[model samples]
Target: MVTSIILINAERTKINEVAEKLQEIAGISEVYSVSGKYDLVAIIRVKTNDDLADLVTNKMLAIDGIAKTETMLAFQAYSRHDLEAMFAVGM
Candidate 1:
């Protein structure tokens, strides 16, 4: 799967609504309303890079209150629990 993190900036009044709308979109796995330089974060998982592009450009960007987006493609995933399990396997 192709995974990406999209940092979203929306109209202040519409941040929650934007997040709700994003969660409804296909291929958007998760949406978070956060406090930071960006208003929200969206996690996108798709079958292909082209699918990612289509979801972001055609679906997400077309939303009414979304102003800007910065997309970061994920290269790898690491978690402490997974790491611990791996080490325990050697025991």
Candidate 2:
């Protein structure tokens, strides 16, 4: 799976509406309301890079209240639980 983190700048008054609409899009796994330079963050999961591109460019960007977005493609993923499990098996 390919995962991407998308930082979204949305119309302040329409954040909830934007988030709701985003949730309806395919390949979008999660949406979060956050404070900072961006208004919302979205997690996108897809089968291939082409699908990711289509989701962000064709679908996400076309949403009504999205003002701007910064998309970061994930290179690797690590978690505390995964690390602990690996060490436990060795011991």
Candidate 3:
């Protein structure tokens, strides 16, 4: 599976709304409200790059109040917990 970490910059007042919207997207596995340079983080897991692209471009970007996003494609799973989690994606 392809995994991506999408860091989001949302309009301050609309962060919660943006995060709620992100959680409704199909390929996204998790959405987190975080503190730092980025206000939210979305974890996307899909079977192919095309699926990842569709989720990011079509669904995620269309959400209101998402000011900006930076998507990072993960290359390898280093942590044991993450490796185990990868097997559970499609189940």
**Candidate 3 per-residue lDDT over residues 1-91, each given as its tens digit:** 9999999999999999999998988888899999899999999999999999999888876898999999999998787888677688953
TM-score of each: 0.85, 0.84, 0.87
Q: Mind giving the per-residue lDDT tens digits that candidate 1 earns over 1-91?
A: 8989999999999998898899999999889888889999999989999999899889987899999999999998786854897789994
Q: Model 3 misses residue 43 by how many Å?
A: 0.6
- Note the Cα lDDT for every prediction shown: 0.91, 0.92, 0.91
Between candidates 1 and 2, name the one with more favorable TM-score: 1
Residue-level lDDT of model 2, residues 1-91, one tens digit each, is 8989999999989999999999999899899999989999999989999999999889987889999999999888796854897799995
- TM-score order, best first, reads 3, 1, 2
Error of 1 at 35 (Å): 0.8
Candidate 3 Cα outliers beyond 4 Å, as residue runs: 83-91
Tell me how far the alpha carbon of residue 69 in candidate 1 is from the true structure, in angstroms, after superposition: 0.4
Tell how far residue 77 is off in model 2, in angstroms. Answer: 0.8
Clashes of 1: 0
